[model samples]
Target: MLDLHNHTTRCKHATGTMSEYVDTALSQGVSVYGFACHAPMDYDTGFRMSFDELQDYFHDIETLQERYSGRCTIRKGLEVDYLPKHLDSRVLDADVDYLIGSVHFLDDWGFDNPQFISEYMRQDMSQCWQRYLHAIRDMAKSGLFQIVGHFDLLKIFNNPPDDSVHEAITQTLESIKSAGMALEINSAGLRKPIGEIYPSKQILRKAFALGIPITFGSDAHAVQQVGFGRESAQRLAKEVGYTKMLDFHNRSPIVCRIP
Candidate 1:
């Protein structure tokens, strides 16, 4: 199995060290395990690693990669939040294995935060949904990321908007396809209150129909959670007619069989 979205204590919200996660991946028999901790933002968010700590983050991952050389492939990546003008350009220019673009905030208001759920509720649900989709499309079209993370994270509250957002969803998928970026079938949602994978079955079907390549991510925050829910993600992919999943190195995709 291959899992590209994982977190470490550097992300503040997650637990475990890079070595611990690597050991867990080895135990899970994961063929390729990536440490994609939240990328450092220019300002303090208290959730991501600070810019000053980014070098050490890279060093730690590199050290682990050498330490576990022949046992399993360990990659270094970042779960970069797309904030339009706010993102540091250096992150895109960083020498990393890959980048996972995600939208955790809707213009500064973190819609996925449990503490911010009340704030999300105060907005017009329909408009908020549309805006979230737009942000995703913009992120895809930006041409900076290799994969899109948690495709429908705005539904974190379990209160989905009406079905009138079809056009927006279509555009987002099309943008991802046109950008030649892969979409992650993230399993972290199962741990959330929503209790389902990100990008839901509906979105996954649309992405499959659009010919967008897919990848698997456990989005694990702890050592024990590494490769969590991969079996369910694989079944979902096959049900949607996906025959191959993507693996990345130096930001280039390598096709792998869906097993």
Candidate 2:
């Protein structure tokens, strides 16, 4: 099992240190690990690892990399917010071994502020989805972030979205396949408002038929969730006909078997 989207104390909301996360992953018997802290965005982002503290973060991960060399392979990653206006240039591209492009904030008004979710809840669900999918398109076209994180997270705030909305989502994901970007099966949703995997079974099945690649991430804020339910996700991936996930090093994909 491998998780590429996890946060540390550096990211205001998360609490685990790099080593602690690695240690937990070790106990869980996961052979591959990734440290994907939240990256900067155009808006007033709330959760971020200070640019000043970046060296220490890298040093810590590097130290673990050396110490756990024979135990588990570690990958440096970033979960970049897919801000449409700034999508052409993002930190996920300049740094990090891998990127998980995510659409967390859809508008220019509310950022990581508390009012964001509340305001999002009040907005029209269809309009919300429109912006979300547009952001996804930008992320896929960016040529960065091989992994597409939570492709349909808008549904989390409002479940049982209308049929027209589902059709719109499918259209966007089909473009994801044509763009050659991989999909992330985020397991964190099981604990969130949606209470299921992001990009539900229907989306996964559609990706299967469209020939999009599949990847897995726990998006674990705490070490306890690192690579959570990875076995089950792998089973689902196989059931959907994805035998392997992509690993991009030096900006190239190296196929890794899921089973």
Candidate 3:
């Protein structure tokens, strides 16, 4: 199995050391694993790493890669938020295996944060949904990331917009296809109130029809969560007619059979 999205203590909300995560992946029989801790933003969010810690984060992963060389493949990566003006170009220029671009905030309201749930409730659901989708499309067209993380994370509260949101979703998928970026089938949503994977079956089917390349990400924040829900992710891909999943090395893709 392969999982490309994971977090560490550097991302304040997550637990476990880089070694612990690698050990857990080995136990889970994961052949390829990527450490993609939330990248640091220009300002403090309290959930991600600090800008100064980025070098340490990269070095730690590099050390683990050598330590676990024969046991499993470990790729260095980051889950970078798509904040246009605040984006840290270092993340894009850094020597890493891949980058997972995600939309976690709309303007200043972070829709995914638990503390901001009430703030999300106050906004017009339709407007928020449309804005979120447009942000994702912009992230895809930016050409700075190799993977799109959790395409439908706005449904974290189970308040997904109506079918009218399809146009925006289609536009985002088309942008990702044009940018040659892969859509991540994130399994973390299962642990949230949403109780389903990101991008839903509806979106997944459309992405398949659009010939968008797919990748799997557990979005693990802890050791036990590594490779969690991988089987379900694979089943969803198979049902959508996907025979393979894309893996990355230095931002280049390698096709592997969906297992």
**What TM-score, computed on C-alpha atoms, does each candidate reach?**
0.97, 0.89, 0.97
Candidate 2: where are CA atoms >4 Å away? 86-93, 109-115, 158-160
Residue 106, candidate 2: C-alpha displacement in angstroms:
1.7
- How are the candidates ranked when ordered by TM-score, highest leading? 3, 1, 2
lDDT of each: 0.88, 0.74, 0.89
- Backbone-clash count (model 1): 0
Q: Report lDDT (Cα) of residue 161, candidate 3.
A: 59
Tens-digit lDDT string for candidate 2 (60-112): 77788899999988887777777756543436545567778888776664322
Tell me the tens digit of each residue's lDDT in model 3 across 67-152.
98988999999999998988977877889899999999899888888887889647888888899999988998889999999999
lDDT of 3 at 207: 95
Name the candidate, 2 or 3, with the larger TM-score value: 3
Of the candidates shown, which would achieve the greatest lDDT relative to the real structure? 3
Instruction: Report the Cα lDDT for residue 115, model 3.
Output: 86
- For every model shown, the clashing-pair count is 0, 0, 0
